[model samples]
Target: MGNRTIIPFGPQHPVLPEPIHLDLVLDDETVVEAIPSIGYIHRGLEKLVEKKDYLQYTYVAERICGICSFMHGMGYCMSVESIMGVEIPERAAFLRTMWAELSRLQSHFLWMGLLADAFGFESLFMHAWRVRERILDIFEQTTGGRVIFSVCDIGGVRKDANAQALDKILSVMDTLEAETKELTQVFLNDSSVKHRTCGLGMLSGQDAIALGAVGPMARASGVDLDMRKLGYAAYGKLSFEPVVETAGDCYARTAVRIREIFQSIDLIRQCVRLMPEGDVIVKVKGNPDGEYFTRLEQPRGEVIYYSKANGTKFLDRVRVRTPTFANIPALLETLKGCTLADVPVLILTIDPCISCTER
Candidate 1:
């Protein structure tokens, strides 16, 4: 093979909102092969688990990725709960589920807005963020934080969803959904947007699975895997199916997330209806004494958190498998055979949260 031009894709770049370096081997404008480098954002959060008590590490988990802060906390809590054999209250499970759906909703909205911004659709970006802010408003009203809603405790949630506040959240969701639909129509029907996105990055089902693709990336490629099927928290009670598209392209990824936002709305409603009246937390008397692995379906995809405790305040080990890190192989494949102009759209489709990946 002739020596291909090597291009470093990130670590710092305007199009990339996070740090992930991809060494792309190219023939003119066509990518031949891609090698990914991570760890730039790693802050030894996992190692910190060995020193900090399980309950006290929620704040540290919140720093894993600011945008996906809640999911990080939930993942860690779920892992520890599994290890401790603590039974969380049903109400606590439902509350956490509602918060999880809200987190997914807002994160997807943020991705949609960033996609618009990538394509220079500034107005669309503003419209998406505007609707997202309404969801964030609901979060702040309930949990007292817009981004890092650290409402999750070790055995349960820290607060309850009051009736008045629930009504307000539902009302806001209804209005936000309506407005979002109106604005999304422009992206869906726009000829230019379609031209730029539709076939830019194509990954077949076999390839997506072989590379261990997760979240929207795998869904777009027609893989039927979803961590929610494992049913942690209240997902077992929620009725819904994963969003899937067989196109295996940028358009399919976009379609999966857009449809998921609507799914999140329905999920939040179900959690509220099924919410049991009880205390939010169950007290734990001692340190965790075993290892546990818990999976969660974050907005990006399936995330797994593993922890090993030694019957002491400090953990023996903690490991996390973030979505973007798992999807990097799929990302490289999509970049191949695509024209230079299609790079941004393809990258955005994976909805790369390299911050989460590197962390």
Candidate 2:
């Protein structure tokens, strides 16, 4: 190793939307080491549990990250529910599952577009985002907000999608699937994208496990781990398997996400088809008296939420372990030995969500 030059990669870079700083130690054009630092966007959302009532804290959880807002809220709600011994309605469980999957689909599409843009494929980026718009429109009509849907509550969902509305969502999914196929084709087969991503930022399955990688990052390396299989919410009633790839590279992560989009679409269809008609929410009585921890499979990976209650309106403590936080070490590992030009691609592969990390 010759003279090492430290290059700051982010906190105000065009490639990354959120403010994440990475100090890159470079030897010529290759990255020798990458140390990531993030705190610029820390909102101390978990601390809000002390101020907001247990029921009201769902809103704070939702604001953790706009991209995975639904999952974050759902996780918090589930943790609270477990402590309160509240059982949600069957129909509401199905509704939460469908919405969660829709969030996953939208998140994956957004990531695909960003990945395209990172590699200089602007047209592909536009195409991917255009398809994502359909999902956003559905969210607006169903949840009253496009980004932060304040629909999840302690006992169940605040709103309900009727059968007709559910059918419309399925129709939209059909169209989305058709439109996404074109983008998927480009992402999977295009020579330029393959050259930029395939075999780049490789991590072995063993390394992934050792580094505590989660979500697509671990799944891409053939580590069969998905919190959904734990049967939280309607996942127990749904049938699906975790998408896995053994390549442990950027392309493998891309493939896992792409395949997961289709899987999420299928899951939504199943949820709507078998949904039971009943009240969307139930009455939750008494303050939470115990502590509970819940996990959910987000588009990025598994997120953990810990909640403690003291039989009061306000919770004692709430802690969130976002997926990106868990994957940062793996990200630093991949950055080593990669060409400086490919740094953006590797970062995008993890689908880094700095807002979630700092929250």
What TM-score goes with each of the models? 0.96, 0.99
The 10-residue segment with the lowest total lDDT in model 1: 338-347
Model 1 CA deviation exceeding 4 Å by range: 1-4
Model 1, C-alpha of 350: deviation from truth (Å): 1.1
Candidate 1: residue pairs that collide: 215-301
Error of 1 at 289 (Å): 0.6
Model 1 scores a TM of: 0.96
Q: What is the C-alpha lDDT of each candidate?
A: 0.85, 0.92
What is the model-wide C-alpha lDDT for candidate 1? 0.85
